[model samples]
Target chain A: MSKYAELFATESRDHLTAMEHALLELESAPADRSALDALFRSVHTLKGMGGAMGYGTVSTLSHAMESLLDRVRSGQESLTPPSIETLLQATDALASAVAASTTGRESALDISTLLTRLAVPAAPAQGTTRVLQIVLDPGTPLPGARAQLIVGRLARVAEIVRVEPDVAGMESAQFTGEFTVQLRSAEAIEVLGDAARAAGFVSSLVEVVPRDEVRQTPLSVDATWNTGDLQAPLQKYVRIESRRLDGLMDLVGELVTMRDRLQVVASRHGDPALDEAVAKAGRLIGELQDGVIGSRLVPVWQVFDRFPRVVREAARAAGKEAVLVVEGREIELDRSLLEQVADPLVHLLRNAVDHGIEPADARVRGGKAVEGRVLLMARRERNSVVVVVADDGRGVDRQRVLAKARRLGWVTDDTEMLSDDEVLRIIARPGFSTAEQVSEVSGRGVGIDAVLAKVRGLGGAVEFSSVEGKGTVFQLRLPVTLAIIPAIIAQVGAESYALPLTHISETVQPAAGALRRVQGRPVFVLRGQVLPLYSLRALVGAAGRDPEGQQIVIVEATDRRAAVLVDRLVGQQDIVVKSFDLVRGMSAGFSGAAILPDGTAALILDAGGLL
Target chain B: MSRQLLVVSVAETLYALPSELVREITTLPSQVTRLPGAEPSIRGLINVRGQLFPVMDLCHRLRGVPGNEAVDVLVVVSDGKTLGLLVDDVRDVIPMDEPAASVTAPDEADTSVVRGVGHSGEMVVIELDVPKLVRSSLA
Candidate 1:
């Protein structure tokens, strides 16, 4: 794979996320100076990265986005909600274009739709705002360098509102020996003329003013740049390929297992020096593993930062005013886990906006503030991270939801009044929607089941609590790392397997007579609950018969729980999850494989797939 | 122009893949872990110098026989992903004087996975379609 392609893809994604965040911020604050600066920088970086990677389509798309944001920054274009929506769409197009270029697949992504919208004339510049056109002498050695010198001198005298042929274009010498620099300064033409003359290399300078002589508001260039919002210094960082990091982590994973083996060996031998060395190695391996996993730990903000935009879009689509307040974004999570949950978090936000939050008038009539609030708060609780998406709007209508559930045959008429948890479980079922018809906002058939499935796949759990007419909160409890998860190792037949502890509700040795066959399916009854039983050996296609006393591990998925019968419970330990080649298309019901303490591989059972 | 091809034997049948596509050939890893739900063709994952890549059993793919071979593996870059092809044995790298002949049409069931068979002098080599094999197998 090309390193340039990887870098371009990653950098472009970061810029797009940042741009989307800033666009949402702009939508709320409109004239927030720092937000505008952030938007401009993100667009600028995207343009530079795309151009450098030879992705002309992506670079051109970024250029269009940059120009649009530039107009908004200069107050030449009104930053209306619709305009921001168009800009967000353009950002998405740029992201897709970059993804296409990196994947060695030509995308049919046409940016013409966005470009045409962007080309629509912006509002005319206010007042005497004029662009100073400077022509470098034909003999100038480096027009780009000379242009920078001229702009630097002018910035001291006036706010450099916008520069024609942005830094990347100028540095690449894409410009002719002449360029235009728009400036907002109170100084007269002659006074600003002196500063331009001092920079030299200027063959000539010309000023073009708008017909309207109303002086525009003074620019906030100083304040924005001084805040380091525009001129944020590049932090020192080494861009190590994540592949190399992953390789190192894999080696560390092996080391961790080997460390356990070494401990066992040392305990048996009991040699003083050997024990000392083994213990020291174990300590070092633990440190190394932590270091590797720590490197993959990224602040939740990386994913959380995107939610405001999602909430804004959902609010706009539903014609409601909902504010997303994210907390505990500083909490860090494994990079891979963070990426996996991003989609689910986005869906939850959309659900919160579309279903939980009411429109402004409705909310106001309910004696609440006109603007609804969607709180996305995350915090560390003991071992797992808890992310709650709570919306202070109209909560889920319990009566409507229960009626819908009964109609769909999800619940019988004889069923008792459902508890909050039971109601949530019902709503999360696939194809369960209380909405009368599918709307663009929330109902398109696929319900919260997809979200639960994803979270479960990542070894996480999703829980919800709601009160009618008040609010609803969807709580997602996720493991800190997807790479190494705490799993209960169970031995079935001659092979060992691991089931994520998160999926296991309880383990019990069902009495012989407790096992019953119903419709040719074996099930185990415990207390009052009867669970479908799966033979771990038979599932893995092992040649074996039922053991004398089968150990049943009760595992829970989204809507069902099953009893997984194993020969014996080996023990519990942290396992390094290694993904199967996805092309293997749903291999026997295994979620992933993990390295055992014995340095062998054991398939991690998918509790959800069992049922 | 002579084309250099890496000749590999799987289930008594010889196949020729472009040499450039073959990243390396190494002894089959002893601890190739079996995935639970993976297709039989995928013999699970093997860690080569700390990097884990999925091992594709060539015999399972070609002849529908389980590849129990403990021989050498040819690591090939197919569709930009590195995967191990479990070959019974890795034969010598040979040069063929002409482009692979198109006489042998791809199997009726799957058109793109196996390219036309080729004759390398006395050796009849089934030219393996790397991209198509990777795409179809992985998917």
Candidate 2:
């Protein structure tokens, strides 16, 4: 595809998505005028674009769909289920045609059936009158001829209800380039603008819509306003490829290392002037690093926008009624991290709709609304973003889950009651599900284990809870960013390792007797709790450590708190984490590799694995 | 096919790799963080500029002979990923007009890296498959 074709394809896909969304809304509320307006506007834009691109098939199909929507908007025809279905199918065909056009191929799709179904004549065109106030450039030759051409262009789309000047008056020299042409048509103002421009130079054209229509038109951000700014997005937002941003990030990291080296060199020189300049360089480099990282952040709405449709589809497939409520879409996160989290969120939402939400009959019998609700929310907590997927459906059947767990030997048969934590553990086991054993989940969707692995693989944690006869809630806590993070550096023997500050609760110097053995497992007594203690020597195979002074860092991960002992606390600083997965057969615990301030590399520790 | 070869030595055994795969050859950095539990052939990691690369002791890896005299590091890229091969000393680069002869010996332990042998003015040089060598070493 040419660069222009790529832009066209992307924009056409966006409009198609919007039309689908508006169709779903109309399906739920047929009387919703705003949804109808949005639907009409998107179809109108698609038609205009398709026509400009020379794709006759796409333009023709979109034009028919636009006519139908315009009829509904002007009170000529009401939206029916059959008409909505036809609109949806037509949108799909339009998308296919657009995609095919990008590859320089003609779409083989037979849109005749869809076009015929959409082109039924309206029952009488009631109250569809619009006035076009036209103006031509001043001191132009053949002004009367220009006026005639404008009227002739508009006469094709609408009935010539009225015209200000008679034929003689227009032909005579007394006629200025200004005139009013009142036409009756069920079309958007953009279509008329296109027709007017097709004739000759139109200096100015305004649609004087009826009084009620004007009030509902929403002068700002409505159909008419968006048409004026159709070319604005391309001129407004510069589209830089993501790989370029990644390259800039790498260069900034290199600059940071250079600044560190310069600072060391400046200190060795002991010259005051060079020292001041190096200090200033260091500050500027720090700010530049922050700016580069900030550029990689995008709002969560980019991922959240596609989820409502997912919920609706899943609900329809399961023969249930479910509505998705979203919150906190404006929160920002690392672009890569946000994208990686999208699939897991999709799985949880589908799971909630299929499992947590009861059927319409069950909901009605339970004294609840017939339409179930699933809430997806994102909120900032400390250095992490906590996302929640909750539904007001039948809660998990714990008895069935416990029986299945016992049968699989995941939990002991003699165990009477399993806590919420135990239940989550059992269900998230790799091969935990069966055709016979289902809680709220019917074991028909993506395995919960895969979801858990994906979230945890990104250095995130998951929380699960269910109350019988109520509903289920799943919380996924993820880091705001992964490429750069603040970490605590700890030394063991001659090796230095970084532990991210997100997982470290505090560091403590345990007293001589505070460290004791419980059942031969080393445990630290911190505030009356026996937290498991792991020594750096055993974990990383450090030859030996100083027994005289031992510092323990308390780490909390996946509901397990543990104390890790190291030789000494070196310091804390922000480090850029680089992907180290290229090295296969390496030990399983290290998360990534980062360059230290001293120009050496240190492995970043993984909390989920360590604890 | 004509090709440019970079020759290096590990424990007195000479080896030649395609020059196109070689990124650079430099002295081992002062700070090499030791990964204690890794394979015996795996020495540790080295930070070149700001990127961390896993440095392997080539002598111990291919010949089972420890690299006691190894000092130079050859940084090579394969499939967009990089690995550092630690060798003994700087060697010469040779231009060949003919391809190396394929060696298929049943007694060879590592067939991944040493797939053929070549000659350079009466001296024998083992032609190395850099991509397979990287994969075998990592595996």
Candidate 3:
């Protein structure tokens, strides 16, 4: 498919997702006019864009859906569950059609039947008139022609009650590039805006006087009031295909490699002129690469926006009173990473509502507020994004986890020896559920394992801290970008290896006296903590004995630290991670490979793999 | 006409590994860091060039001979980064004509390691299945 088709598909899918989420929210609070308006606006926008893209199927489907939303927003018809379900089905159909169009195939989905079912009975005309103030951005050129075009467009949707400045005086009046148009039709404000934008004069628009606001004002057709049409602003963001971004990243990697080669050549020949030129070029290239990659990062809010409705519906399904509070939604992360994290966040939110939050009666008895709060907060840390999903309800019962672990044979007779963190890790293990009964939502002993895997797959870490009666917070620490990592190159016997410095807890030169054997395992005492030592040589199957004296690199994986004994310490370097799987079979302990200075390959150690 | 053969002596027994499987040749480090709990065939890991790669002892893994010899050469052969096999010596890259394949095991040799016996004029060249050899060593 062509790139433009992909862009259209992405934009349409986003609009559909927004529409579905808003519909779900409106289902619970049928009287919420803002949500209804937002839902109507999304469908209206989709209809117009689909028409422009020549996706007739999408346009028709969205037009039918928009008509239904108009009736509901105008309070002529109440939102019922079946109505919401039909809307969702229509959304699903639109999404499928968009997907099909991008693949160069026509969608055969017919939503006319469902749309016909949502049609509201027309009410008798009672001579009620509504004024829609059209506001154009002052910077818009051809003001008079644009105004005429907007009026012509509105005539198709609603009867013109009155046009301010009286057509002839339109040019001389202090117009402020804004004009009011009184319409006699019962069409929704969103539909009106859609009609105006279709004419192509409205910019940065909103309905300042929403239906609810108009209802509050006791205006019987002759109400003299200032009503300005809010211009719908052009979308500030554009969706780019991930594959294209990945291709760009690959080119950048090649550029970095070439840069390194140039530096090496310049340094080896001791050419000051060449060195200075290469250095200058390298600095500029570095900034360009960073800026290019940074452009791909989107705020976490893009994903978080969908969670409010998810939480609302999930809470209702589980018969619980829960409120979802999101903070730091503006924290930017790589788009791919954000996509990867969405599922886990949804799972956590579902669990919070289904299991963590108590029902109203239970909450009242426990002296907690009836409305439980699940806060999903994200923030930027050094080189990582830390997201925490915290729920204010009954925290994880440690006793139950221990009991479950015992019953599942995950923990041995030496149960006390295992730390709380280890016990919590077991909870993330497959088929380990602490819920008393399997609930349809989450208690079936699934999702957590997948969540853990996804987080780890993104080169991130997940940790859980709980207070029995208070709540449970699952914190996820993820690298800001997956394209690069700061690594320390070390020698394991005769081979050099790179270990990501993020996972390196500390490096210690343990003397002979500091090494001791505990239970047949080598342990090194550093700062009063006994860290397990794994010799890199033995782990990698090198032939020969380890040198008598060697420095140990203490690395952290999951929540524990282990000392990796290496032959010698090579200097640290920022390495571009190249996938090991692409080459052949999975490397035993190496996460990836990177080319080092002086033009040689370095095997990057996988800390998680070592665990 | 005599067929050319690449020969390496492991514990005084002539063994030939196809030259195509050899990725590169490097000098053995002065000391190999030993991982205590690892399998016996896994001699240790070594830093070749600047990358730390796993080095498998072909002597212990293939021949079951544990020799502590100060070796000058280590053949760094790998399917990828995971399995880097260190051989005592990489003698030569030779071309051999098609020879009759017959099962003939050297004394105390595991049959799994030997593909077949091929005659290179006077010398019996043993064909090695590289992956199979590594798997058996790992097992």
Candidate 4:
């Protein structure tokens, strides 16, 4: 048994119990964010430890289950009763795997079908579609063939969505020159027309009328936030106790509230200097909060730089020559998150050296470089940090994995070939390597399941792509969802509502007639950006306690933004968010609840759902 | 063994809840933040000692009597989840024969949440299944 096996097993048992507890809690309150988060954290930590301890089957199973959970956290999928049952069964299988892995062996349990059940299929492509009507000269020869040629020409610039009467109908004797084609693309109408006419058939007008978007004017309201890069290595502090920092944050939160009240008082006084000072204090407070919060998050390099040393030792152990390459070292993650990921990352690096890289003699026979190249890179992608662990070595043996999967009744007899993703699923099955020497020869099946699970628990994902005898690339993607931050509390009706300050582009009190009716829907044009206006009165239906002034908060999420009109602005404050049970009936737009300084609970709005 | 029950009034009808199941009883605050899209029987939520508890109006929940503001709240626990049951008043805590007081009232027509209707001479109290009540209505 490995030196870390006992420690890993003990920790894993506790996490498993916690995960089951969270799962049971979820069964009661399906929308409990804290429960879901706890469940994800436990799964993630276990996967990391399992990988670090060199337990392949443990990691594999953990990864499969984590993918399902990641989908649920990102709102890409939901937790149904059946899925919950599958998860419970997965927990039991994982517990047994943990027990078996302590002895350096895979669990003799076949859960490939269960793993398959956990997979969330990819979403289809979304693009603006347009319909083109082409009328050719009445006496044109081979009109159908001409249409087909035009479609093929247009395919270079646009996706050929559909053609009227289908391909067979276009080639039929009953075909007409006026058949319509639906094309989805980002090209200009003139470009599409030219491509259609380039086929050289006489035509009436080659105009493509766009489908569905002509009635309303286009709105450009997606005000994306730019979290600027971490500046120079200044004297930001080597280390500080997190509890003390939390205390400092609380004091700052109070200062922010004081600033809000001060602004109101200063503005009422009509003194420019006082107002300027108050505004400056607000800006300073915002910066201070961001800095303290950012300080709590350590850069990826803190943990990543240690991996090269791990790879060096691993390569030596495997009798292989390997070089480790690291990039995007400055990407920041919550310190605890970075710590949890380090162990799994080490396992992946070692696995690459011991299993992925070929022996020196084998490398020469394969006509490849003497030293295997391993890359550990991190890049921020929208709301996630994608950390890729790729290696230039012999890829996974798909044939062997598929055959094993079939024998385990994971895939049917007719299953012939497997995609890179399918190969991952097969390798992650708890019993994939239980057949002893089969796993030892196949390469790259060790500790992968647990690594996958841990990332999923963090509401992240692992994407696999490989080529036979070439190499394998594994991308671990994790969400950088906000934990604690400043929020703008707006009074809507009789309640105070908190919106994450990051999601809001700006707040404005529109001039009279600025909020116009476009097709009977209220919209506001702000500095040339069109934003849809949603009335808080109409949305929440809480009776207003006498209006003071209406304020519109421009909230943005992904590619959508909208103006939420509230009773008035209650100013900005740094809210200390505590993990609380999800109040199921608190409505769809609300993400969770927080207690305000005045001792009343306020619902925190989810910007994504609001838009 | 004797079963101890805390008797309370909801729209003037006497009901008994097992004393062990009751966490504590407190006066219902006048103001409650309305939870949007919640069931009609839910009289919104109240923050008691920083912990928010959804208040269930027993008057409307049980008897279909709408819009009655309950005076007292019976804070209760069911399956680790806590809720405040709004009632008009808490009459008393009385003890009765364990099995005898738990028998189905002979004249009772329906048993939706009523476990039994117990009687002591002319005094009667309807014992409710707390878990059943939470499951059937709160959700």
Candidate 5:
């Protein structure tokens, strides 16, 4: 990896995230000044960083976005839904530019079209009443011709409503270094300010003044207001790379591991002097790790902050009326997991908007509120984060799923013997689409499978449940962090393996008499329910005859539990996971390999891989 | 008109695989893991030092009698990673001059086991095709 690649990755990711959040805010309260300001700041920072990093295309595009936002923020222009659309497009272009920069490829960011759209005059009805305010620092000597040119450029956007030191008044007295203008135009205030700055003015100030204050009803026409004034100082925020945070996390992981090892050694030796030292060290490391990891725990709000815009656009596209309610957005997760989970979460939210929510008329006919409600919730679970997307509208039609499965030959006479969970699994399969028609937003049968695959790929699990005529709920459970995990070490035949402890529901030696044959598969009665048993030796391709008897490790994959029989239980140990590329055409029953305490290599079994 | 060859024995036949393909020679482990549902030639995954690698039994792959004894030497060749190939023994690497035209195998000869026959004076060197041998064993 290049020395700066990680920095670029982290910085660009943060910029994208901030841009997403800001766009979402803009979609809802389009007139919210603070939201516009935040969006402008994010764009401005991205442009600055991109320029510093020699990503010229990204810098230029973001610079255009910054200029547009400046206009919107200054009240020189009003934010329309179309403008928000343009802003979202610009955000996408910025993301592409960043992607190109990181990959060392030149990106052609054709942002001129979007910039032109943004520059288009605001709708006649929503135009802002322009105010021209000018302030010049006493330190600069302003040549007369340049000042005149500055004043002339401002006149194009709004009427030259006011010019300090009227031509007759200027002859008698030197200009007092500052002036203000009260004019009427719906354009954003920052446009005028940027125009002044560009015109070689030493300082410029611009703000929207009320039409009533101007005591004039401005005609709904394109006009410019010239107010020769100095602009106020812009607010600035610093951006940092996430790798620095990750580096800190790495140190924290090492500290925690060392602390655990020290505790083990101290307890085993039981020396009083060493006991005190280890105790102090353990406390210090615990605090340090928590502090470091806590620094990387970003609130779920970062993800949820983008849903309002998605719901709005999706609802509009689908001819539906929907309200998005987000709760527990303050719940924080590891920053890395947050990034991976964001896309899938957005997809789920979009699905809820496009498919789960019914049209206002349909909803009313169903005795529901005209507006559909989609709720996004995040919460901390034991060592994991649970993110839920739920909608209050027409729920999934199980009959349709069953019909489709039957038509696809996925269901048979024997499938009638399968439970509802098994039927749902079929629907989740790749290429399974029940929608009668595809929509622009979703229903291509692509994203859901990707969502499932990604969640599983990240070692997380997704659960779906729907109540007909009510709504659908998708619950995603993800590990709090991916850097480390608690795993159980067990011996399969002669080789030892580590299985993620999260998947292990419990381990018990099934009574020899309790084993029963169910559909030609060996199963054991656990709590009065039959659980399938798989031989670890057979799964791992071990040699020799199967052991006469073995211990069973019952593991859970979503709602299903399976008993994995191994020759011996070697007890549990937390092993650091190491990834290896799967050989082409290799389908061995393991996810990756890890090093054991004795430095022997052992495969780490994937619970989901078994499925 | 001229040829160079190295001959090795599998069962009673003399086979020649190009010297360029012979990567290295080493002793194989006494015990081998048997992957169920895998081909007979695949001795299964093995731990070589601290790394996991796969070992293939050449005799079984070549359709010779599968040896029950621990392999005395292992020929490690790279097909990506170092694959351990169990061989009976290494014969001398002898240079040869071209004799008559190469001949096709007879019905009794395992065509799948031999690529072609090279003649050098009174000795005939049967060329071993590793991929074909592996495929036939796997099939």
Candidate 6:
């Protein structure tokens, strides 16, 4: 496909997302006029774009949606729930059509069901009229002829019910460059605009007064108003393909590394001019890196926007009434992280609706409100974002969970009262579900474990708190970005390793007597807690014993805390993580490699693996 | 199309990697950070121009005798990653007029590393299969 076609596909997907959000908003607030206008404009632009790209199916479907939206905008038709669903389904079809176009394949999706739904008959013409004010380019050689051509084009799309200055006067070539052509068409304003543009030499299109709005206030037909300010999206931001943004970020990372190298060289030479130049470059590089990384951040609402619909469907299927309240949607996260976390968040929300929420009759019997509430909130903490999915319904039954754990042989009878940590661990084990019967939505014994694995893979953690009668709140703490992170470099043997500081609690110089043995396993008592101790040297298969004065770095994974013994603690620094292909025979202990300031490679240890 | 190859030796075996894949050649660096849990064939990681990449010990990878003498590092690109291959010594770069066809190897290990065997007159040069070697090293 041509580059332009590729660009159209990307832009069309963005537009589709906007349309979906607007349609959802319209469903919640049927009388929201601004949302209706935005929805109409999105479909209008999509139609034009698809038509230009020769995507006949997408354009045709969008055109049908625009017509129905026109009726709703004019107050001739109302937006029902079924109508909203039809519009959403149509948008999905358009998205697939856009994808097909990118691959140079004709869209074979049968959108006839959607097209029939969107083909709502237009209201009869009731004398309401739209005054379209068209201005021709001043540089056109023959302004009068251009006006005639435009009027002829407008006549083809709509009825030329009223032409200012008289049709005979226009034919006589006595008018200026601009003329007001009053149109009376049941078609949306977008169709008329297309027709006007199809005629040459038009510079501007103003929907001076829509048909329904003009009905309320009678203005002189000759009096024209500029309504071009009502355009959607306002052209305030430029749309850039994310791949180009990634390329920019990669270049910035390379620049930062080069700047570090320059700083090292400058310090050695002790040249004042060189030092000044290097310092300036360093500051500029820092600012550029921030800007590049900032551009890659998008509001979390992009993912949160789809949850309300998910909750509605899941609640309906489960025979319950649940309301999803989303907060902190404006919080921004790395775009790639947002995409990665979307599915996991959806699964958690489904788990809440499917399992945590009780049916309506059961809720009243349990002395709770009939409607269940699921609150999805995101907030920033230090260097990570914590998203919590809290449901106020039937909380987890600890007894049932313990019984299931016993049945699965995950814990023996000797296991004491299971703490919340132990409970979370058991739930996170694959194929460990307390659900009595597998439901279609979730809880097939495959969800929570997958959620744990995915979150951990992205350098995040998940935990939950449940009260017998109150509710359950699942919290996911995730790093803001993955490219660059602060890591504590430590020596395992003769080799240096970097550990993500997100998981490190502290480094302690353990006294000799602090060491103890529990069940033939090494353990260290820190602050009266017997923390499992593992030597990094032994874990990495290194030779020799750890030197005296070795420090135990306490690290936290999911629900467990452990101490990793290292020879020495190197100071912390922000390092760029570079991914490499791990050979088949290699161990999976290390996450990836990082380049230290001294121009050497340090394997960044995966903190979870240490546990 | 004519192609250039960089010939290097590990122990007594001769190997050649396509020159396009070889980014540069430098004397082994003094500080090669050893990755303790990495595959035995991966000697360590060497930092080149602020970028750190895994260095594979060709002698061990090719199942040849370990050489104690100084080795030169051949930094090459494979699967979009930069890797350094340590060889006993660097030989001359030779041009081949046409593509070399594969010859049946005496064993599976030799076939896995050698894409084809090229004859530079009487000297037999084992053409290194760069992608397969890197994939196996990472695997």
Best by lDDT: 2
Expressed between 0 and 1, the share of native interface contacts present in candidate 5 is: 0.07
Candidate 1's C-alpha runs over 4 A off are A1-248, A364-369, A402-422, A444-446, A510-514, A517-521, A527-529, A557-561, A583-585, B36-42, B64-70, B97-101, B105-112
lDDT by residue (A1-611, candidate 5, tens digit) is 35354456566667777888888786655656777777877888888778867888778878888877787767666665446666776676666667667667644335556556556754534444444657665554543444556677777766676766555443344666566565555555556667676766446464533436334532221121112101211213235589898777665655665666677778889799999999998888778766876777777876677788888888898888998999987788888888998889878888888779998888888999999999999888998889999999787787777777888888784454444466458767888876667887777656677887778777788888888899988889988777667788877667777888878889887786767889998888888888888878778767667666678888886677888888888777655555532333354556666555444456777886675
lDDT of each: 0.76, 0.79, 0.71, 0.72, 0.68, 0.78
For residue A435, model 5's alpha carbon misses the true position, in angstroms, by: 0.5
- Higher-DockQ candidate of 4 and 6: 6
By the lDDT metric, which is better: model 3 or model 6?
Answer: 6
- Higher-DockQ candidate of 3 and 6: 6
* Leading candidate by DockQ: 1
Kindly list the per-residue Cα lDDT of model 4 for residues A1-611, writing each as its tens digit: 44346546666777888999998887655668999999999988888777776688778878987888999899876664445656776777777777666755464545566567667432213476766677777878988888788888888888888888788988888887777777777565556668878887847543332424533422121111111211111222233677886667656655655565577678789988888888998899878866766766767987997888888888876668999999999888877678888877887787777667888889889999999999999999865688999888988888878888888899989999998768877766665663343333224454677776666544345778888788888888665533455689988766887877756879998887778889989898888777898887676667755375688999864335799888888878766453333334656666555556555666777665565
DockQ of every candidate structure: 0.46, 0.38, 0.03, 0.13, 0.07, 0.45
* DockQ value of candidate 1: 0.46
> For residues A290-360, could you state the per-residue lDDT of candidate 6 as single tens digits?
89888998889878978999999999988889999999988889999999999899999999999899999
| Candidate 2 pairs with clashing backbones | none
Off by over 4 Å in 2: A1-236, A257-280, A434-446, B97-112
Candidate 4 residue-pair clash tally: 9
Native interface contacts retained, candidate 6: 0.62
Which residue pairs collide in model 4, if any? A44-A454, A56-A447, A59-A449, A59-A450, A60-A449, A60-A450, A62-A453, A63-A452, A63-A453
lDDT of 1 by residue, A1-611 (tens): 46446645656656777888998787666657898899889888878777766788778877887788777667666564345656766766666666667766534556666787666643333333557878888878878888898999998888888998888877884678778888777565555667987989888776653324422422222121122222212423345778888778777877877787778778998799999999898888888888988898878887897789899999999899999999998898888889989988888889888888888888878999988899998899866888899999788888888888888888989876877778878888887787665779767655798988888788777777888898998889898887777889998776888999877888998886878887888888888678788888878777668778768898985446888888999888778888745554645467777777656677788776565
Compute the lDDT for candidate 6.
0.78
Could you give candidate 5's per-residue lDDT for residues B1-139 as a string of tens digits? 3444556765556666656656555566544433344555666555444344456666666664575553644443434444556666667676655422346555323465566777555777677665554434332
Off by over 4 Å in 3: A1-239, A414-419, A582-589, A597-600, B1-139
TM-score between model 6 and native: 0.68
